[model samples]
Target: MTPSRVIGYVRLSRESADSTSIVRQRQIIQSTADSRGWDLVDVVEDIDVSASKRRLDRPGLSRVRAMIAGEEVEAVLVWKLDRLARSVVDFGTLLDEGINVVSCTEPLDTTSAMGRAMAEVLQVFAVLEARTIGDRLRSSIAYRVGQGDRWRGGPTPYGYRSVRHESGDGKTLEIDPSEAAYIRQAAEIVLAGGSLYSAMQAIREAGSKPRRAEAWSISSLRVVLTGDSALGRQSRHGVPIRDEAGVLVAPWEPILTVEESERLRAILAPRPLTETRRKASRLLSGLLVCETCGSRLRVNSRRTAGAQVESYGCRANGDGRVCERPASVNADQVETFLVDEFLAVVGALPVVERREVIRDVAGIAEVEEAIRHVTDSMREPGADLGALVAQLGTLTESRDALASRPAEPTIEVVESGETYAERWARSGVDERRAVLESVLTGPVPVKAIGRGYRRMDAERVAAPWAWLDEAAADFVDPYWTD
Candidate 1:
């Protein structure tokens, strides 16, 4: 004489909506089970999910079906018929398996013919109600957006955070100060002529990450940097959605100015990949900039008396008369001078200045990344080599261009009185590279002294940072020449 087993089910479309709350629905089903003397198996609930979708759409509904199929329950109980299903087809399928259906709130049960008729009639109203609600919600959001209202829900975009007021009007958007700093730095780096790749590296070096991704990815950075969001304008589906007066409405202050945004956009804009660049054969390839023609110094290795001597040659000489600067500097000589200069000065700078140097290092990394990207594009299948060459000409020019010279940082603190040189001498390749890059922009230029012998002198090396500059020329990049 065991009581008949039954499983209860409930659904609440909106978490805040009070008409059909989970607690209320559970009370009704539990009471119904108590009165009918049916052994309650379990209560399945779909929170904040609409009943208008297919039965398969509701995880709770699917769970209930499996429970009944496993003979865990012989009947299903719900606060209302629509809670189980809004469609009459789904309504029939719920009872198709010979499991009786009961609606506690509705004056109906599947055991009687008249009850089935009333249940179907109630389903029509339920479906109509759900559709009406969905339509109203859509119109309301569209109206709010048209009115230039702030987006009310969803995660905050990059460089922003959600701010909730105590008055409970709902959360508003605000610039996340620390995260916003990265965005500002990005715009500055690019405005000062750094690429998106450089911006990404700078951001990571500065210790900021995007909201979603682990590290600054190319695709993610493109979406964040190129959009109107950088200007603080609200966007929908990745594009800035305009307001009634045709103005871009932003809930929070913009991270970048309009001019800055446009400049960034121009820099980020798509270009034809035509620079026929081969993979870097040397560690310092594309990092070195020529003071004469401002062209990239390509890596060249030649045999001299059965020993190989590596040198960085002017682009003009390598590519059939592109530059008047045929001068090549010994690679080892330049690298050692630059590294020595970095170790001597960088570690003694103020911690804050050290941090700035790291950011610039990231910027340098970004420029190198841009070069790699351009090189990759030119090598893609069916690339227009001629067109790509022209495009690469511009992109690679920007990539090889040196950042502004860093000021001579006054030395203050010395840990254990150890010079940066001592630390460099003891450090590994990776540590040495980081230390060097953090202080001076890469590929120390060894301009020939008086255009005489190709004597690689430390006094002739020009670094963006004062730490590496043996001679402070503060020279601007000469116009890219043939």
Candidate 2:
């Protein structure tokens, strides 16, 4: 009688770290096949793939399934049952296909009823172990985050480079002055109303290169501009991580101030489809609101009697819910009016920079180090537990006191010495928009004017900036002045 044909499957979680794992599994499968008097057709492999997490998309496993479906093999051989699948749902899927799975080290023989029952029990424990390992890893990362340790896992950010920590076990980010200079230049260009491609040109001129690609692209430049790493803040999955004190957790010195970061984000934010396609070329594209339908005013251009007239009209006119009296005004006139109004209001106010003050109080770093020393000493064999306990208590008290202290952040007001009119000449649309947004609480309402009225009406445009109180001066950040 001919021996049954069987295929061997192997998987390794980390291919580079565990070179011997694949070899070991292959040897076990070959030896088992010889002992069982089965014809070993071929061995398939999936390197650096985890069984518990990436179970469905394994190429080698797909080949095994194809062979089983084609009746090319009577049985599938693995070093262990978990190597086939860590989850019951995955293993049950294979069992329901009526394919016999034989494990070299485990008693997972899908042909027998008792063996199938045993396989289910073992799969449950495998899933539990995978989850427990995941939990421990997440807990370890959380502890590190709380301790203000930078994660050295992924690629280092553009403006920063990884360096060995002073204590020497882990890595920390340090501002690379050469690369960081380019970040500053790029931000300045964007803030000054220059395009991202223009910033890319500036970065290239400074002899700075991007991290991954050979040359910098606009998208990559935008990523660097908007990343939390530029603000010296730690983030996971695009969300900033805050400490227990509610302050953003910063491990390294900042490349950009919080105000600069906020302004860059605002400037680089995506415009609406209508604005982008038609190009909001005007300064007040999204800022104007129709008083009738409460919709934003979008720029519209029409050639009336051989002259191309650009105007800002109610967007609701095209959105199926037409405004009863759609507001329309010449684009150039309304922008000029709003700018003049904004400048007349708070444009001369000295922009105050509000920043969180940082101080090293109560020797918190020293206290934490002392606590770590005491905790380590307590773990030593035949150590003095009583003395170590006393030291730890004293260190903990000092640390708590430092943490509990309320942070007194003072507003630093720096006078730019330049009035609004003087800075307005040097500013771009983005800078002007930032200024307008800081003064106005919401969209400015534009009431409809009489048809064919060529004269610009100041009454038609409502100024939210004029209504703002003096206390609103707190919202202003030095833009063109800086």
List CA RMSD, all candidates: 14.0, 12.8
Provide the global lDDT of candidate 1 against the true structure. 0.66
lDDT of 2 by residue, 375-417 (tens): 7768899998876677667668778999898766665554545
Measure candidate 2: CA RMSD.
12.8
Candidate 2 has an lDDT of: 0.78
Instruction: State, as a TM-score between 0 and 1, how close model 1 is to the true structure.
Output: 0.54
Candidate 2 residue 266 Cα shift, in angstroms, is 1.5
Clashes of each: 11, 0
Q: For candidate 1, lDDT tens digit of each residue in 1-482? A: 23389899988777874464788889988998999888998998788887775454789888888887888887789888877888867777776765567888778887777877787788888878878987998776665455444554566778888776445545557788888888887776566444577778878988887777788886788777777666667766555664332234565677876555666778888766875655534445556777777777777889999999988877676567565545578888777766665445554533222112222422343345445655676779997777657655765565456455353445442232334444344444444455444445455565644445655455566777743356645732111110
